[model samples]
Target: MSFTLERAQAAEPKILANGMKSFDHFRKLAGIPKLDEFFVDAGELEQLLPGLPLSGDSALDKLSMLADNDYRTYAVGLTRWNTSGGLERKREVEYPPASNKIGYFNGLALVEIWVIDPPVVKASCGHTVVNPLHLALSYSDDKRIFDERVSLELGNMLEELGYEFENRWS
Candidate 1:
């Protein structure tokens, strides 16, 4: 579920030299597959397909791609993936010094999640931070329930991780 320091360091050069999409040749490296981050189970895929921002035609096309492959382990033997979490926290120890990233590698973590109505998973890489809440959308009209459930589930998960929040919305 995590990236290996060695394999990640090896792939880092390619992403650094060219953009993140560079080195397609080395895409099938010796590590975890990247598809896990994007694709869900076929059953969950059907339920969440509408949540994705794709046209009707493109969505169908994605199903076509899925039909032609074995997901979850499509290319388990290849394709390396990493969280890319702390790599940006301090690529080099200069300017303002931060130790959160280092502590993240250890078992120490302090989550300060923002309170928002719609559920959004904020992903950060380098200088890019994207909150793709749109992916949580569905065709259902009773969206408030989903929002409440998200808040509850997220709160439960955070609490299970031994995090307690102050001044958080109830």
Candidate 2:
């Protein structure tokens, strides 16, 4: 698929075009690099979620396998802080009970893809804090969507921390 998201649509349609227009627009504004890969075929997806019974041995088994794979593939970053003499060093923590809930909204197919390393706050010194870094990858066409989503999320986070707009933007 070309996935081009150029000309704006006359009106929001019931179905979201898989074209890359909206994604490109978001990427340009976020200053993110183009994605390297975006499409995944059924076989590839199967590799990640194996144990599918041919046609009725046990559909539940296949579902369990898929769910397990989903959880393993998507992870969100977690962090914890420690107090020290005048200064603090941040530590990257593991995901808590309910982490990694990144979802894709395609109008018809809305699925929550597992998050691999959700960002987490590591430490704070009442002035500055550290957050775990998470790098997301995708195909060039969808880079903009990922960029916009991350930018908006990060912006809100920094704002909540009371960080100055200039510093946060920088």
Predicted model with the maximum lDDT: 1
lDDT of each: 0.25, 0.24
Model 2 Cα lDDT, one tens digit per residue, 1-170: 32222322332322224321232233233332112212223343344433211111011112222112122221211111011111121222122213345532111110112112222232332211113111211112222233343344444433343321222222
| CA RMSD of all predictions | 22.2, 19.7
Off by over 4 Å in 2: 1-35, 48-132, 136-147, 157-170
Q: Give candidate 1's TM-score.
A: 0.17
Q: Write the per-residue lDDT of candidate 1 for residues 12-117, one digit (tens) a residue.
A: 4433331332222222232322211122233433342223223111221232221211222111111111221211121221112244353322321111111122
Q: What's the CA RMSD of model 1 in angstroms?
A: 22.2
User: Where in model 1 is the C-alpha error above 4 Å?
Assistant: 1-146, 167-170
Candidate 2 lDDT at 100 equals 46
Backbone clash numbers for all candidates listed: 0, 16
